[model samples]
Target chain A: DTAVSQTPKYLVTQMGNDKSIKCEQNLGHDTMYWYKQDSKKFLKIMFSYNNKELIINETVPNRFSPKSPDKAHLNLHINSLELGDSAVYFCASSPQGHYGYTFGSGTRLTVV
Target chain B: SQQGEEDPQALSIQEGENATMNCSYKTSINNLQWYRQNSGRGLVHLILIRSNEREKHSGRLRVTLDTSKKSSSLLITASRAADTASYFCATERQGAQKLVFGQGTRLTINP
Candidate 1:
């Protein structure tokens, strides 16, 4: 079974629309993170939540927001999506304060 | 940007050959991790080396860390075609809980 899984593996939305991506981990992890991979294949941390507590928030756009319903779930919501927002989004998790992270398969989002 | 940077952005090798990728970071680190990502897929954790540890091995993967130099290396021996993927080095800076990922090095193992 996949340790980390994200829903809506493919998303196609229009500009000015709002979209959300859901993520869940089955590894009993305490820390979950949201990462964005740009067209250049560069991945950057957008947000990180440890045990449902906000821990790390990078210089992400205000339009993007991350919500943690519980320790096993972290979802990302983007408002007024723009073409520049088109990229792959990944969700990862790990045991609290651990060095290794298990990543989800990723969601490919396209804004047209 | 406190991020790890991998060198030789890309490498192509034949099957049964060894692949080596190096990463350098700017500050002191708590641990260094290596991840592999196949095309269009998310990253998979390969190994981790702590600051106090000099080297670590798992199966065909070997990881080396030099705290003084703030650098690390990942070696995959007897690489197969399936080994072709982008390798990234992530450094968890001292007192920093999250990882700072490198630009990554793409390796192509031809069979």
Candidate 2:
């Protein structure tokens, strides 16, 4: 079974369009994260939720919001997506106080 | 800006040859981890070394941590063609829940 899974493996949308990416983890982890990987392959943490509580919020724009209904699910909602939003979004989860993370395959988002 | 920086952004070597990548971080960290990502795939955890530990080994993967220099290195022996992937080093800072990743080193194993 896939420990971490993300929906919409590929997404293509136009500018000013809004979309959401869903992520779920069956590892029973306490912390879940959303990361953005740019064309250069530089990964950046966008948001983090531990047990459904917002813990880490980077300097991402307000257009990008992350909601975690529970510790097992974390979803990212982007409003008015811009051209710069074209990149791969990854979902990951780790157990409490653990240093290693299990990541999903990733969703490639392309904004035309 | 506690991100880790990896050296030799890219490396290419023949199969069965050894490959080494270095990572440098700005602040003290609780632990340092190495991950591998194949083309069009997610990152997979490889090995993790704690600040207090100097060296660790997992199969053919060897990792070393130097807290004084705030640097770490990952060495892979007998690299195979399937080992061709981007290697990233992430550091978990003290009192931080997030892991900061490096720019990554693209390793190409030629058959």
Candidate 3:
């Protein structure tokens, strides 16, 4: 079984449109995170959720929001997307006290 | 902001050669991990060296952590063309649930 899985491997939408990306992890980890990798391949943390509770919210724009219904799922919703939002987004999960992470294949978003 | 920074943003070497990358962090950490990412794919966990550990070996990959210097290094020996990918060093803080990542080092193993 895939440890981590994400939907919409590729997304292409015009500016001002809204979209969502879904992620699920079967690792049974308590902590999950979302990361964005820009064109230069610089990976940065965007948000973190622990057992459906928000843990970390970086200095991302207000248009981006993360929702976690349960410990096994976390989804990202982007509103009023712009060209700057064109990047690869990755979902990762790990145990509460463990540093080992399992990352799902990223979703590449392109804002045209 | 990124907690760790990897040196030699990009490197290229012939197959069967050794590739070494260094990472430096600012603050104290409980553990440090290395990850590899191929183009258009998610990152893959490579090795994890705890703060108390000085060195660890996994297959052809060796990771060394120097907590005194707030730094770590990953050495890939006898690298093959399939080893071409970006390498990142991530640091886990004492009490944080999130791991901060560093700007990766793009390694190209030429055939």
Candidate 4:
């Protein structure tokens, strides 16, 4: 059973376009997070939601927004995607704020 | 700006040998976690040690935490060629929901 899964394993789009990545976690975790891993392999947290409540939001661009319609799902939407938006996005979930996270395979986004 | 700093950025050893990696963090944390990541994949949680705990072990992995020194180490015994991967330490800051990861220590185990 896949604990965390993301749709559209790969995404390729042009600038000014919009794309969304969907994530689902059946681990029954209350907290879910989005992280971006750059070419340098530096992974940074972008956003985190707990029990469907937004908790942490790093200094992410306004073009990127995270929405959690329910506790089991969290989706990330990028508006007017730019070249800098190209990176691997990973979805992670934890039982609480301080537990080990179960991460998804990742969504490789390419913006041209 | 980096919270976790792993030493010896990379290491190479023969199969059956033990591999060790160290991680040092800047701030106080509720717990520290170790994760393994292959070349271009997602991270897999290995183990987690809370501030109150000193050591924890799982399978062939052993972790030790020293809160006073703000450091942690992961030791993998009986390494195999398949153990060649990057290991990272993630620190969950006290009261912070997000985890800060280290710059990873890449281990290359030779058969």
Candidate 5:
């Protein structure tokens, strides 16, 4: 079984359009996160939630918002997407205080 | 901002050869982890080394950590073509729960 799963493996939308990506983890982890991998292959953490509570919110733009309905699901909603939003987004989860994370297959977003 | 930076953004080697990747971090860490990502796939956890430990081995993978230098290295022995993937090093801070990742190193294993 896939431990971490993400919906919409690829997404293409026009500028100013809004989109949402869904992520779920079956590993029973307490913490989940969203990371963006740019063209340079730099993966940066955007947000993190533990037990459905926001814990870390990097200096990300206001257009990007993450919502966690429960400890098992974390979703990202992008408002008015821009060309700069084109990148691979990864969802990850880990047990609290654990060392490693289980990442889901990334969602490649393209804003035209 | 990312606290870890990987050296040699890309590497190429023949099959059965060894591949080495290095990562340097800025602050004290509780542990360091190595992850592998194939083309169009998610990151897979490979191995981890604690701050107190100096070296660790898992099958063909060897990891070394130097707390004084705030650096770590991952060595893959007898690498196969299937081992061709991007490698990233992530560090968990001493007290923080989030991990700071480095720009990955792309490794290409030529058959």
Candidate 6:
């Protein structure tokens, strides 16, 4: 079974369109994270939630919001997507007190 | 800002040869980890070395950490064609819950 799973493996949308990406983890981890990988293959952490509590919030724009209904699911909602929003979004989870993370395949979002 | 920077953005070597990748961080860290990512896939964790540890080995993968210099290195012996992938180094800073990743080094293993 896939430990971490993300929906909408590929997404293409117009500018100003809004969309959401869903992520789920069955590893029973306490912490979940969202990372953005640019075309240059630079990975950056966007947001982090530990047990449904917001713990880490980078300097990302307000257009991007992360919601975690529970410790098992974390979703990202982007409002008025811009051209710079086109990139691969990855979802990951790690157990409490554990440093290793399990990542999902990733969702490629394209804004045209 | 990126916390870690990898050296030799890209490297190509023949199969069975050894490959080495280096990572440098800006601040103190609790632990350093190496991950591998294939084309169109997510990253897979390889090994981790703590700040107090100097070296660690997992199978053919060897990792070394130097806390004084805030740097680390990963060495793979007898690299195979399947070893062609992007390698990234992530550091968990002291008192931080998030892991900051490096730009990544693309390794190509020629058969």
Among all candidates shown, the one with the greatest DockQ: 2
What is each predicted model's overall lDDT from 0 to 1?
0.92, 0.96, 0.94, 0.93, 0.94, 0.96
Location of the lowest summed lDDT over 10 successive residues in candidate 1 chain A: A90-99
Q: Would candidate 4 be rated incorrect, acceptable, medium or high by CAPRI criteria? A: medium
| Backbone collision tally, model 5 | 0
Q: What is the TM-score of each candidate against the true structure?
A: 0.97, 0.99, 0.97, 0.97, 0.98, 0.99
Using lDDT, rank the candidates from best to worst: 6, 2, 5, 3, 4, 1
Please give the lDDT score at residue B64 for candidate 2.
92
**Tens digits of lDDT, candidate 6, B4-36:** 999979999999999999999999999999999
Candidate 1: residue A38 Cα off by (Å): 0.7
How would you class the docking of model 6?
Answer: high
- Per-residue alpha-carbon lDDT of candidate 3 for residues A4-108, written as tens digits (9 for 90 to 100): 899999999999999999999998899999999999888889999999999899988989999999999999999999999999999999987776899999999
iRMSD of all candidate structures? 0.8, 0.8, 0.9, 0.8, 0.9, 0.8
- What DockQ would candidate 2 receive versus the native complex? 0.87
Q: All candidates: CA RMSD in angstroms?
A: 1.0, 0.7, 1.0, 1.1, 0.9, 0.7
Q: Per-residue lDDT for B109 in model 2?
A: 97
Q: Please, what are the lDDT tens digits per residue for candidate 2 over residues A1-95?
A: 95999999999999999999999999999999999999999999999999999999999999999999989999999999999999999999999
User: For candidate 4, lDDT tens digit of each residue in A1-112?
Assistant: 9589998899999999999999999989999999998887778999999999999999899999999999999999999999999999999999964679999989999999
Worst 10 residues of 1 chain B by lDDT: B1-10
Q: Chain B of model 1: TM-score?
A: 0.97
The residue ranges of model 6 lying beyond 4 angstroms of the native Cα positions read none
Minimum summed lDDT over a 10-residue window in model 5 chain A is located at A93-102
Q: Tens digits of per-residue lDDT for model 5 on B1-111?
A: 689999889999999999999999999889999999999999999998989899999999999999999999999999999999999999999878888999889999999
* Quality of candidate 1 docking, DockQ: 0.82
Clashing pairs in 1: none
lDDT of 3 by residue, B27-82 (tens): 98889999999988999999999899999999999999988899999999999999
Give lDDT tens digits, candidate 6, residues A1-109.
Answer: 9589999999999999999999999999999999999999999999999999999999999999999999999999999999999999999999898479999999999
Q: What DockQ does each prediction reach against the true complex? A: 0.82, 0.87, 0.81, 0.79, 0.85, 0.83
